[model samples]
Target chain A: MSEELNVSCARPIGSEVDQGIDDSFVIEGAEASKAKKEETTMIMVGRKAPDFSAPGYHDGKFVNVKLSDFQGKWVVLCFYPGDFTFV
Target chain B: MSVDSMFVHKMWDEEELSKMVDGGIPFPMLSDAGGRVGTLYGVYDNEAGVETRGRFIIDPDGVIQGYEVLTPPVGRNVAESLRQLQAFQLIRAKKGAEATPSGWKPGKATLRPGPDLVGKVWEVWKVDQAFED
Candidate 1:
């Protein structure tokens, strides 16, 4: 018989956002215009990951989870878009 | 983890995702509702409003050992991730004395890092004789 591992899932405590928030700001004056730019920087390897504490879904339930909780274990953090959507 | 909420994750798991894997997703799916984590990882496309494909391999001590962020058109390889994880674990077990060569696997001969093995690795590491053990 195979033993099953019970993983805990945390749930967020608020409603989900329906749309993505625009982080850009516009200047009102004619000479104050600036080009719209999308700046992105890659997180370097061999550095500490940013700390995060959020709700996670697992095993038919929601639970509070944090990055620090996995201190002594290897963690593979993958971020993808929503389900049932094209990548 | 995904940007979708827990409810959405549950729905996806029940509807279609669970059948794709052997034992289902063993890891927790974090809900980054506001894209906070995605922005930190630098994979969030503000205009597209979604995180690009990103994979991070963190060690036991919480240091990021490896990471890859790809465009939306590409998918990641799970086999590579497993191989990297196993390689890291092996190096950790060996206390950093041994290093893995290209295409190295368990039971294969590992190279010992030193000045002596710098220019003459071929003498000690024959391709046909390395994996016999």
Candidate 2:
């Protein structure tokens, strides 16, 4: 890793949201306020998944698991340091 | 781990994982290739370059709907997370326009938008719109 990369903050990626306020009952202003707060630390939602493929050890074998294979099921892809031996 | 190798290798062996599964450990432990998945997910320690115990709940469509990242000494609650998953799945299944409230359980009340909705949220079936300010 570069030392220069370590000393700075990375800008958030994605589209900018408008926070302009026009009225009360219209409720667009309140929505902008909430969006602004969320924009600070919010992870991107409703986007295409990052493509990935891996060998998963299951049932005494290393089976190939890809993001595309799970087209119809909810896949909880979790990554940990090694294996959680203490937990 | 190198970026070219992320999610390519199983972090643990089958025997250890089998034991965890037999002990009622739910969810699959994806290998991050040395720790490549962790790095891309931002849960990886750049200095050490290993996963930092992060969990992500991806929807059926392959989108990461929700996630939680934790540092060492802090663990994730599987049961609670499962509940959240159930709520998410249920809400999605129903196609109701609402989000689950705190401690939301399946088959319970959900929230909707309206003036009198809050009063009867416990009786309705959506929780997203019933969130209290």
Candidate 3:
């Protein structure tokens, strides 16, 4: 990896989110509304899964797992309403 | 992930989920407090103050190949998830040389990619099955 490339903040191939040339996340008013509109639809197929890290429970143990840790492997990430309730 | 705390996840796994699944779901049940991660996945329900039920299948390269979202009352299908995973793995193994038909599962027919498959699928599915390797 070149120092210039690193400075540019370009993610490697097959992982392409957060790759703006300016490396800025701040959205202009109109773009914020457009981004919010995109968020509502949530059609995420054919896109990079967003990376995250959180405290988690697994096998009677509490641990922290980062979504990026599962990189280079298939993952089935599930989200439910709550722990106790079936809903 | 949901807005619930990790402590709540521990309680639910011990008190409820472990009984349902022998190993308590076999994966990390991450806490998404304040709907942070849930918001990223678009599963957080601001009106309801909770995250909705959803599942995402992500391939090795970090791409979101598929996802299913269900409301509070409805339940999602594990079989469908497994079928889709199998299909994705098969396609990857074949290097995209073959494709799975709708509702396709492991050990079933796989279609070859090309123009010849159009309108000839039903008869050709069996033909494709014969060529499976």
Candidate 4:
């Protein structure tokens, strides 16, 4: 699969995502502006959770976690405010 | 998870979170640096350079089943999240044959959905049935 993300802003769908072999999205050139972003809606129920890969801390270890890593399991992503600080 | 760096997450886990929950956060504390992921989810506050509190329940299909995003001062309801998760699972298992009512809990009565049951839901599903289990 090509590493480049399509320009249209629509998410890719189907079996490519299920197997976790698909390339991650890389938005090149045009940056999505803040003004444009305000028009973007929150991800709704039944829509695909945008796939992401990032570093995470767990059990005294740091590992890179991808949303696809937990496919086929119910995942609850609880995003809280900064650690050690009250929100 | 927020815009904190990986090392900050380590410190928070070792210094603070461990004191609250046994052995620190039970699940991975992801570092969404710059609130990139948060931005995609519409929880990022660019002006503050931080991501607000948010919770998303994604089913096995990678589809979002439920989500809640909030600003500060309002605490998240863990019980409500669990209820939603259970309800989503039940509905998925039933393949749309049945539906859980308000405040539904596991083992509680499930309503069979159909045209005939549209207005008759009250007859088969009682308010008391939701609290039975």
Candidate 5:
């Protein structure tokens, strides 16, 4: 990772990010922004949930899992690059 | 704490994960096919067509209470997420609409509602009664 590419996460993507071990790079910049510039006036504290219906391989047959399906449950929605790897 | 699992799809075998269970990794894994959920969550690694590691703990009310999107090649803490869910439930039950302070833990003091209480919650056990006015 070069020094110029090691900018902090104060700015959004396309600014700069750390390089992965494989020489690959991923952005860790700000994913959200606020309307005001001051810290006290800023209010970007909530998460935005996504909606989709997709066929999941459940019970040996494909079933759909929609965002609304888990409406009443606390959803721990995670995303991983690939399974089986350490990450 | 009630928590559901959802993950982006990648080729993995259940048997391998089962063998590593006792090694400290906890929680069930779900698969998100075709990077759809990854794109939606803004954690998709576009060049690789897979999601970078990211975690979110949504409350039963469907509000996200704990979230972390790690840079690629970095794993997440499943146990930490579970702990967060428990704390979030306890706080939500006691505080309702008021927000939780950073690093909030169970049995700790919380900020009360109303303008008079602003900045009055100095610590977990030192809430000034005057702010209740």
Candidate 6:
């Protein structure tokens, strides 16, 4: 994501309920908020990938893997949903 | 990788997933439980609360060369990914002087990208010379 838009800064979509607000207005507000969130997303191609460290399951053990650790080698980072599903 | 924990990955591999494959999954499946990497990669859907199908091809310098994000119903083609990696490797080896044409593979003719070859690619590239089985 872009440096300007921190995920932590995003508030819940429909958290605050306005007593006098019309239902359609609330829906429109939620949609607009979602669109704004989507706009802040960054394209990954041609950009330096964000460095990350996470626990990985490899060779029957949980190993700590970092993106920077594979700096000198080509890396294919494939992200799927959950395990044992259609993915 | 999945957002599940390492324990879940182990269980899925041993009990269910690996059985369907020949030798099981060869690559390391990283756990993004908190969706940190997914969020950074712009594949995490906050509303749906799941990571979309995303694949990234990063070069040796850690720069992303290509990426694709698909909806949940669509599955990515592994062969296509391998082909892209091979094409990138070939281009890098040639110092960006040559470019891979469509459906390019190893031992196939690479186009020397230049002003002359801009609009007349079909004239230079024959159907038989394009790809090899």
How high is the CA lDDT of each candidate model? Answer: 0.72, 0.54, 0.72, 0.74, 0.49, 0.73
All models, RMSD in angstroms:
8.5, 12.2, 8.6, 8.4, 14.7, 10.2
Tell me the tens digit of each residue's lDDT in model 4 across A1-87.
012222233322211122342335533344534433443444788878877776666677666677887889999988777877774
Clashing pairs in 2: B99-B128, B110-B125, B110-B126, B110-B127, B111-B126, B111-B127
| Candidate 1 backbone collisions, by pair | A9-A63, A10-A56, A10-A63, A11-A62, A11-A63
Best by the DockQ measure:
1
10 residues in a row with least lDDT, candidate 1 chain B: B124-133
Better of 2 and 5 by lDDT: 2
**Would you list the clashing residue pairs of candidate 3?**
A79-B1
- Model 2 misplaced stretches (Cα beyond 4 Å): A1-43, B1-20, B23-29, B114-133
Instruction: Please report the candidate that would top lDDT against the real structure.
Output: 4
Tens digit of per-residue lDDT, candidate 1, span A1-87: 111223437434322222222447644554332321122233678877766666766776666677777888999988886677765
On residues B10-81, what C-alpha lDDT tens digit does candidate 3 reach at each position? 788888888988767677777777776777788889888888888999999888989988887887888879
Instruction: Report the CA-based lDDT of candidate 4 relative to the real structure.
Output: 0.74
Estimate the TM-score for candidate 3: 0.78
Query: What is the docking quality class of candidate 5?
Result: incorrect
TM-score of chain A of 2: 0.45
Worst 10 residues of 4 chain A by lDDT: A10-19
In model 3, how large is the Cα lDDT of residue B71? 89
In model 3 chain B, the worst 10-residue window by lDDT is B124-133
User: Which of candidates 3 and 5 reaches a greater DockQ?
Assistant: 3
TM-score of 5: 0.58
User: What are the per-model DockQ values?
Assistant: 0.38, 0.20, 0.37, 0.37, 0.19, 0.32
Q: Tell me each candidate's TM-score.
A: 0.76, 0.62, 0.78, 0.78, 0.58, 0.75
Compose the digit string of candidate 6's lDDT tens values, residues A1-87: 111112233221101111232235444578876754453355657777766776666666656677777888899988888887874
Better of 1 and 3 by DockQ: 1
How well docked is model 1, in DockQ terms?
A: 0.38
